[model samples]
Target: MDPQHHDYTADPHLHASHPVEENKPSVWKKLGGGSLSISIIVHAILLAVGVVWIFQIIPATEQKVDFMPKGGGGGSPGVKEVSNKKQRATMTNPNTPRMAAKGVASTFTLPEPDAASSMSSVGSLSSGGLSGGLGGSGSGGGRGDGHGTGFGSGTGPGLGGGAGTMSPFGMVNPNANAMIGVFFDTKQDPKRKPTDMTPEKLRDVIKEFTNQGWNERSLENKYYKADQKLYQTRVYMPVMSANEAPKAFNCEKEVQPSRWLVIYRGDVVAPKSGKFRFVGAGDDVLAVRFNKKNIFDHGYTQGTTALYVPGKVDVLAGKKEDREVERIIRGGAMRVPVTLYKYDTTANWNNALGGVAVGPEFDVTAGSTYPIEILISEIPGGLFGAALMIQEEGATYQKASTGSPILPLFRTDGSLPDAKGKDNAPPFDSQGAVWKISPTSRRDI
Candidate 1:
């Protein structure tokens, strides 16, 4: 081989090219790539769950509920049933009278006026005749007669007696006194007269007393007279409170648990007849009758915690209770009967503290008065208090004045006087006939 022809293959510059190999990724790097998206999704889920949990822990707002006795229907007898649509429509009209359930009608016997005397006076005035002449007294011209020819001075209709002065038929003075009776019962006796457990007996007793023309004063002394065997008498008033009254008879015994019964009788006068709503708040059992028909009946197994003290634990820590009752009341005066019963066994607290507020919204006739009454009772326990409030339709809710009594003015004869023509008369009970407590005086627990 020639020396110049040394192998060109052996030269370093003449080599063939080779392809490059890719590097494999580590496990940590692969996982790190997807971590951001996974973290974001997990955080979002956690945030949503937190929001839902917050809502669950908070309590919901309280709502009004209808309460009825076990056997009673939605409304009492004589109350015409109307659709919700019709009832709502009627409520909007101020002039329409509410259709109240018929109860035992009250009978009032008024003395007849002497017609002969009135007619004779009218005849005499007519017989006197009139002397002509526009402004004169003598035979002619100038002012002569002592009486003016232009007008006659006659007494306007006697107060509350004239055509428009009295309440419409089936209505009574709203300011009239409510007869109230308080009884203590030991439910152990099933045959007990005026049994606190029997609603029918309670109604009968109310009717009998009303028919007998018993007033608040009269009922006060006769508390134990209803049933001396089963009932222990306490206090009676046009309006009453177990908390404020002095302890009486068997009720003073602390060891012997006793049931309570309270009866209230009066008239409710609507300024303008229309739909009215009634609301009650308190502990234990309460019922209301309008026109002698049961309109509101509330029975609760758990009782009420509206006035319960915060931080004070209760073994019967049940739900808070309340009721809303609606009724159609005729304009003018309506008979109203109210009953309150508290069973010592069922009540969580020893003392009952509660109230009834009627309509923050209701239509009423202008310049009309309404009669109101309240009866409250409680067994020996903590604090006791109660009140009844009337709210004008569309008005804001305000606490009623508790310092003074809400009572009606009376004539000298112990009868409710007509609102008309009685300007100077004093109230029958200076403190007022209605029951109410000042906010400061109320005892909650």
Candidate 2:
């Protein structure tokens, strides 16, 4: 312990035996070796954890919806309807005979079948255009009975009331005038045409179809639970009954204009201050509403129903013409003697169904918006269309080939659909004349 004073030269034996223990392998070296081993072990553990964390699979987190579902909390208190809706197919203005609302001839007579030919074959060729030989439609539609799904009476182009081209888009309206169109599959609704188009029937049908509670004020219904509930601006679908709307408008699940209804309701802005009337027609039903009042109520099936409100309905109801109208509408598949009515006369149009009809004149303040509800319905199927036009007092228009003055189509905007030929051209003259809508219509979309 007290070796500081004892010199190594003085004690040679002790010094030789010990020899400073070969520098005692540095303390720093020992510490460094131990630290390096600990560092490696710690790093290895951290790396393994990192690798496991990175490579491990994590499940997708599910989103939760917290709310009560239809039919209340329990199952099956009431029946829930599940509708299979489809998207629209491609759109093209194919030649469809069903769109012959404005055919060239005011009169159409079915040609007597060539007994010698079609009886043996022809399976009722139904191609809509000129594709058939002595039958069927043209435009690439194959030979008879071979045109796909169903059979129909053999007829040719320019025949069977072949008026002119009844284009799908006969009128154009602006987005402001556009209304929300709600389509209803009324096959389950027991009520017939005119009634089915009514608000009462709509409520009943919706109540039966939906589990949701309904009230008179609500336009909402189970039918609104649709993906295709798009806005409709123009009322120029003359060939809607011709199996075109479902394809033309790209409305998927809704085929066949029959057993169906579409109600269009929205605010219409007045373009000017004047006495104006809505003029046009529908195959089955077309009812217009302004300020909760029925402005125009005319359709094919309207004649079939009892006259509930006489004065409010077709102004010419009690006359002899209505009886004829009832007969024609109730009659099966006849296209002629289509409905034509004015605010004054039913004598000119004995059969009231598909031609132009005028509503009573109403006053509107310039630029003021008014609520409007329009309904187009089909009860009995086959060949459907509706034309809506507007006319101001003393407004003269281009005369159609039928010699009727072509009125401007009722529209909010100047935009229109690219319909084919004379626009079906219609009693309203969507083609010969401009499709000018209410210029004073308020533009508050």
Output the worst ten-in-a-row residue range by lDDT, candidate 2: 86-95
Off by over 4 Å in 2: 1-177, 188-225, 241-257, 303-354, 422-445
For 53-109, candidate 1 gives per-residue lDDT tens digits of 999999885432222211111233223343566544433331243232234244422
lDDT winner = 2
Supply every candidate's count of residue pairs whose N, Cα or C atoms clash at under 3 angstroms. 16, 31
Distance from true position, residue 123, model 1, in Å? 59
TM-score of each: 0.26, 0.45
Instruction: Name the regions of candidate 1 deviating beyond 4 angstroms.
Output: 1-176, 188-257, 271-275, 293-383, 396-445
lDDT (tens digit, per residue) of candidate 2 on 115-197: 22222113211233212212223221222232221121123321111121212321111233345555555442222223234
lDDT of each: 0.29, 0.43
